[model samples]
Target: MKKILLLSDTHSFIDEKILKFVKQADEVWHAGDIGNLEVTDTLKKLKPLRAVFGNIDGADARSEFPLDAKFEVEKVTVWMTHIGGYPNKYYKRIRDKIKLNPPKIFISGHSHILKVQYDKKLNLLHLNPGAAGNHGFHKVRTMLRFELDNSEIKNMEIIELDKRG
Candidate 1:
C-alpha cells in the first residue's frame, strides 16, 4: 500500500502543519499555483515530488516540473496535470507510445475547491485536493490523502480547516 499526500493552490504560503501530516507519505503531489520555486523546492526536501505547471506559477515549468506526467507506482498508473479539462490535449502525442492503455488515477487542480469523483464504468478516479492556502474566494485551507492497496484506491479523505478557527 502506498500513502500519498496531495495539495494545491498554496499561492505562496504553506502551512507549517502540512509537514507534520505528510512526513511519512511516499510521495507529495502539488497540483499547481505554488507561486514560487521555493515552494516546490521546499516540498522536495520532504519527499519525492511530482508536480505540474499551474496557471500562475512556474517560469520554467515545462523543463523543470513537466506540464503533465504519467508514471506508475506500486502497480498503479497515475496521470498528473494542473487542470482537469485538457487531458486529450496533453496526451495526444503520447497516446500511441504510452504502454499503459488505461490510467487508474487522474489528479488535477485549477478550481480552488476540493473535489473527488469516481467513474465506475470507466474505472477512473479523479482527485482535486483544492487550495491549501487562501485564494480564489476560498478561505478554508484543505488537503487530501489517498491510500492505495494493490491497484485499488480506497476512498479519498478530504480534510478542511475549520472556518471558525
Candidate 2:
C-alpha cells in the first residue's frame, strides 16, 4: 500500500501545516499551478513527487515537469494535468484524448475548487484538491490523502487547512 498526498495550486506558498502532512505520505502528487519550482523542490526533498506544470507556472517549472503526467501506482493507471476538466465538462484540449484513452484516476487543478467525483461513463476517479495556497479565490485551503493498494484505491481523506490567509 502506498500513502499518497495529492495537492495543487500552491501558488508559491508552503507552510508547516502542509509539511506536517507531507511527511506522513509516502508520495506526493502535484496537479499543477505550482507557481514556482521552490514549492516542488521543497516537496521533493521530503518525498517522491509526481507533478505537471500549470498555467501559472514559469519556464523553470515547465522544464522540470510535464504538461501531462501519465503513470501507474499500485497497478492503477493514472493521468494528471493542470487544467483538465471534470466529467462531461472536460476541457476541450484533452476531451478527445481522455475519451480515447481513459485512466483509472484523472487529476487536475486550476479552479481552486475541491472535488472528488467518480466518472461513471468513463469509469474513472476525478480529483481536484482545490487551492493549497493562499493566492486564489478559494476560501478554504485543502488537499487530499489516500491509499493505493494493489489496484484498489482506499482510505481516502480530505485535508482542510486554515482559512486562506
Candidate 3:
C-alpha cells in the first residue's frame, strides 16, 4: 500500500502544519498554482512528488513540471492537471481527451473548493483537494490523504488545516 498526500494551490505558501502531514505520506501529488518552486522544492525533499504546473505558475515551475501528468500508480490509471474541470463540466481543453480515454482517478485544482465526487458516467473518482495556501478566497485550507494498493483506493481522509489567515 502507498500512502498518498494530495494538495494544491499552495501559492508559495508552506508551513509546519502542512509539513507534518507530508512526512507521513509515501508520496505527494500536487494539482498546481504552486506560485513558486520553493513550495515544491520543500515537498520533493520530503517525499516523491507528482505534479503539474498551474495557470499561476511561472516559467521555472512549468519547466520543472508538466502541464498534464498522466501515469499509473499501484495499477490505477491516473491523470492530473491543474485546471481540469469536474466530470461533465470539464474544462473544454481537456473534455474531448478525457472522454476519449478516461482514467481510474482524475485530479484537478483551481476552484479552491474541496471535492471528492465519483463520476458515474466516466467511471472515475474526481478529486480536488481545495486550496492549501492562504492566497485565495477559500475559508479553510485543506488536503487529502488516501492509500492506493493493488488497484484499490482506500483509507481516504480529508485533512483540514486552520482557517485561512
Model 3 poorest 10 in a row by lDDT: 87-96
Error of 3 at 65 (Å): 0.3
In model 3, the number of clashes is 0
lDDT of 3 by residue, 32-147 (tens): 99997999999999999999999999999989999999999999999999999997899999899999999999999999999999999999999999999999999999999999
lDDT of 1 at 14: 68
Model 2, span 99-126: residue lDDT tens? 9999999999999999999999999999
- Give me the runs in candidate 1 sitting further than 4 Å from their true place: 86-101, 162-165
Error of 2 at 135 (Å): 0.4
Global CA lDDT computed for model 3? 0.96
Q: Counting only residues 3 or more apart in sequence or on different chains, how many pairs clash (N, Cα, C under 3 Å) in candidate 1? A: 0
Between prediction 1 and prediction 3, the one with superior TM-score is 3
Candidate 1, residues 64-156: lDDT per residue as tens digits? 887677888778888877765433432454444332464787777888778787646446676788888766767677889878888777657
